[model samples]
Target chain A: MEQRKATIRTACVEALPLAIAIAAYGLSYGVLATQVDFNALTAVLMSVLVFSGSAQLVAVAMLAGGAGLTSVLLTVVLLNLRNLLYGAALADGLGPAKKWTSLLAFGITDEPFVLASSRFQKVGPDPLYFAVVAGIFYIAWIFSSLTGALIGDHLDPQKFGLDLAFPVTFAALLVPGLKGKPVIGTALAAVLMALCLEWFKPGNELTIIITGLLAPLVGLFMHRRSDHG
Target chain B: MVNQWILIGVLAVATYVSRVLGLTVMAGRELNPAVRLYFNYVPTAIIVALIVKQIFIPSGGHLVLSLPVLAACLAGALAILLFKKFLPSVVAGVVVGLLVRYFL
Candidate 1:
């Protein structure tokens, strides 16, 4: 029992920083979702139900850009591909959760994955630790979304530059991880490809999905070359 | 509104399936390394794409480069790179963006 308490404490301490980051982004997501016409209820509920930050943020951004349901769904699927990798990676640590893995599966996004993977490596199959970290993130996400949405509701999007918040917030989220040859190459490729697509046909619905599917191949190619060289 | 709910429902279902599939069925097996790398790169690619899409907004059937958005993004990226802080970087970005939108 004492050991379990120690694990929970450690998880809270470790997850706290990432949980704060999650809340910041969730607040941004909440604000952004409202700009796209999500009421506070729906915005927070999405956080409650979806619990995938990247997918949620990107979906709201795309909707603001006039993306339709099919387009947004396709783009979100592209974003969620990493969750497959995260789930596979975390399968072992969450093993003891058994049937409850279904509930735990909802938290299989990026931050929790990083924290839980490291925790499992150190402590070995601590489902409680994963739960603790995910719980903190979940609480942070839900409440932050509601708060941001409430704030967003009262504001004028253009006057306050709320529209620009989408990309700027994304920059804050994405820039730190811009490490390594392949990742850098992928981002550069995405930028160029998206520009070309928009130039060819501005506001094309397929631009995001196509660029998303194509740019990663550039990264994959870079990864392959690095391996050979 | 209805579409919003539908989008949420679909996203919830698809997201869960991707996760649960990996956990339940693909648990013991190692996915192809290339496939794994591709998935890892997807978020970066899509995020960059989203940023690009916003920076170049379509207006009147022509691409309009929104300087405020681009500058704010650059400022935010710089803040994160320099301080490694989340909320402050976001604030920096929004402040810079607001200034750009008003003055430039």
Candidate 2:
């Protein structure tokens, strides 16, 4: 129990930076959801259920564009497809556990996965600790969205530089993981895809899905050829 | 009024479907090696993708040539990478973004 407490404490401490980013981004999503016609309940529920920052951004954009239900579903599913990749990486780190623990895997996100997977290598995969981190971030996100939704369109986040939080949080999460050529190539491809897609598919979430799916293929092919040669 | 509620309900279910499908299907399985390799690297790809969009394109068809945003974000990344301190990096980025938005 003492070891468990320590692990949870350490996980929470390490997760603080990501927690702030999630809260700030969630708030923005909630406010935007309201402006896009979702009421408070729907807005909050989306954040709790989806819990993906970029997908939520795309969701409101679709809502604003009067996208049909099928289109919205396709767009959101594609935008968040990366979470499957995230979940797959995370499953290995889950350690020896029972079937019931799988419930916590549903709440997995970028921050918790990174923290848990990296630490699990050393800590031996405490599901309780991972669950604690996920729960903290999940609560922070839901409440932050609620706060922002209630605040409505009055506050200017651009003035407070909230937009910058997304990039900064992303950078902090990304840089430490840039280890090799294939990874760098994948990043470059993703960047190129994002830029090019913006020209044609403005506000569409499919760009993320396409870029994420393709970049790794480019990386893997290059890696294999280079390895053989 | 009812129409709006209906739309919201549809979106809510759609969003839930996306999330639940991934979680339920992929949970408790060992990832194929190729997919595992991709997951390890894709986070960087996703972040770089988003960052490139922000630095080059700020609005609809309007490019902001604001060097401050770029410099600040770079500085923030550098600080966190160097010191492993996230809050300071966050402050650096937030300060730079606000300064560029306000003064520039």
Which predicted model would earn the best TM-score? 1
What is each candidate's DockQ, to 2 decimals? 0.76, 0.33
DockQ of 2: 0.33
| The candidate that achieves the highest lDDT relative to the unseen native structure | 1
Residue A34, model 1, lDDT? 94
* Candidate 1 CAPRI classification by DockQ: medium
For every candidate, give the share of true A-B contacts it also has. 0.76, 0.42
Candidate 2's error at B23, in angstroms?
6.5
Per-model lDDT? 0.89, 0.66
Give the 10-residue window scoring lowest on summed lDDT in candidate 1 chain A.
A79-88
Clashing pairs in 2: none
Model 1 agreement with the true structure over B12-35: per-residue lDDT tens digits: 898888889878877888799999
Interface RMSD of 2: 5.3
| Local lDDT at A115 for model 1 | 90
